[model samples]
Target: MDRPVNALSKAIRRRLGPSRLRDVLHGVPLGHPLHPAMAMVSAGCWIASAVLDVTRSDPRASRTLIATGVGMALPTATAGLADWSTLHREQQRVGFVHAIMNVTATGLYTGSLLMRMAGRERTGRALAFTGLGAVSVGAYLGGHMAYRQAAGANHAESVSHLVPLGWHDLCSLKDLPNGRPVRRRLGYIELFVLRLGDGVSVLADGCSHLAGPLHQGRVTVEDGDPCIVCPWHSSVFRISDGSVVHGPATAKQPAFRTRLRQDGVVQVRPAD
Candidate 1:
């Protein structure tokens, strides 16, 4: 099952290779996942539409909510494309279902808005109700993607729970040159270690945005703070804390505490 799925994903990737559409959806410039942000905006509009339905009968309010809904759809579409482009077949199937449901809901809302503008009040209300139901179903599917599939959730966070206490040798302090990151493995955990003059920093090797290798990233100073610029997407993270300095990544990288043992060995443990 997994083999076939992998083949399918590879085919999809080949078909969509190096596309501007994929880049926009992936939020490549932001260095983080974009779906969650777009989802929040869509959800907000839905809530506002629900409120207007209950609190007022004015066509103007309905039109306003519908326009906002339409506006939110653009980012939602981008996010869906971004997520789908990189997904395995099983996840992609689920994502496709989610996308269909959400897009249908958007269309329904658009029709409702048009109906309301044309003074077809009852038909518009009916369409709005249908759209609301579809959006709810789409939201449920999105939750499944995040919680069950771990889509858009930070994979690096998984290591924080499993990393052993106290310092574990990563590499010799000399192995990492100043302003360059080195990759090392501790058990199943991969880490990116940076030597910054007198200090050192460690973060999970995978980027929070797209699992891009952080070891190949470049170190620079931003606003008087040390940060690593991801080689793949250029997402920047503070060296001291792993906080995102810029996004497509809303979540921070999993940081690790570093030390130099008396034997001059470099060590790291999950940061407290």
Candidate 2:
């Protein structure tokens, strides 16, 4: 399962690299994952079709709504696949099963739509109800991947509250080599430190999208500002203020204020 699943995901990811279509699917401009949001379209249409069936409302309208749901499912699932390709192994495994369930539900709903068009009202309603049940199961798994596993959540959300107030000693300013990114620890918190000329920039070591270690990522200059690109998902963050330069990451990276003490020791504190 892992082999086939990983191969599919990797192929999709490789094909999608930094394209505008991929950005749109990922909801980069909207600052959120688009999959769950767009899914509401198909789900709402299906529920309305069920209500029409129960109320014995115009049969023609009910059939139209069912067909509408089938049309909507295509784009919704496409958006979902875009995000699914970037998930971690655990999330991807669960997502694979979830995708299978959704595909099954869509097929059932399509059959129901065709039955209604053929004037087989009783059969259509039964298949529609069964499809809804399949959707429920798929939604449950989707929620687990999101809430339980924290698939698309901000990994560095706790940094501001966890670090102590005021300046905490990091290391001597001389220790960090020029034009290099290094990791430093303060208690349990880890920070990514970069030295460029006379200035030092520090940010939370973890990527906000999936907690990819920022220290392991490649640093590059984009438009004259230094940024780090996450190795896992390629989300980029500006080092100066930790703002997103590019993303699947909707949240800003937690940054810190750096200053030198009297003895030439460097220290950092949470940025306002």
Give per-residue CA lDDT, model 2, range 152-208, as digits (tens).
777877587887678899999889988889999978988999988868899999998
What C-alpha lDDT do the candidate models reach, one value each? 0.76, 0.87
Give the alpha carbon lDDT tens digit for every residue of 17-128 in model 1. 5455555555655556767677787777776877778776666876787789778898777666646656645666777778788999999998988898888978888898
Clashes of each: 6, 0
TM-scores, each model vs. reference: 0.65, 0.92
* CA lDDT for candidate 2: 0.87
Model 2 TM-score, 2 decimals: 0.92
Model 1 spans with C-alpha error above 4 angstroms: 1-104, 133-137, 158-160
Best-fitting candidate, scored by lDDT = 2
Model 1, residue 186: distance off in Å is 2.6
Deviation (Å) of 202 in candidate 2: 1.3
Write down the RMSD of candidate 1 (Cα, Å). 6.0
Q: List the residue pairs that clash in candidate 1.
A: 30-247, 30-248, 31-248, 31-249, 32-248, 32-249
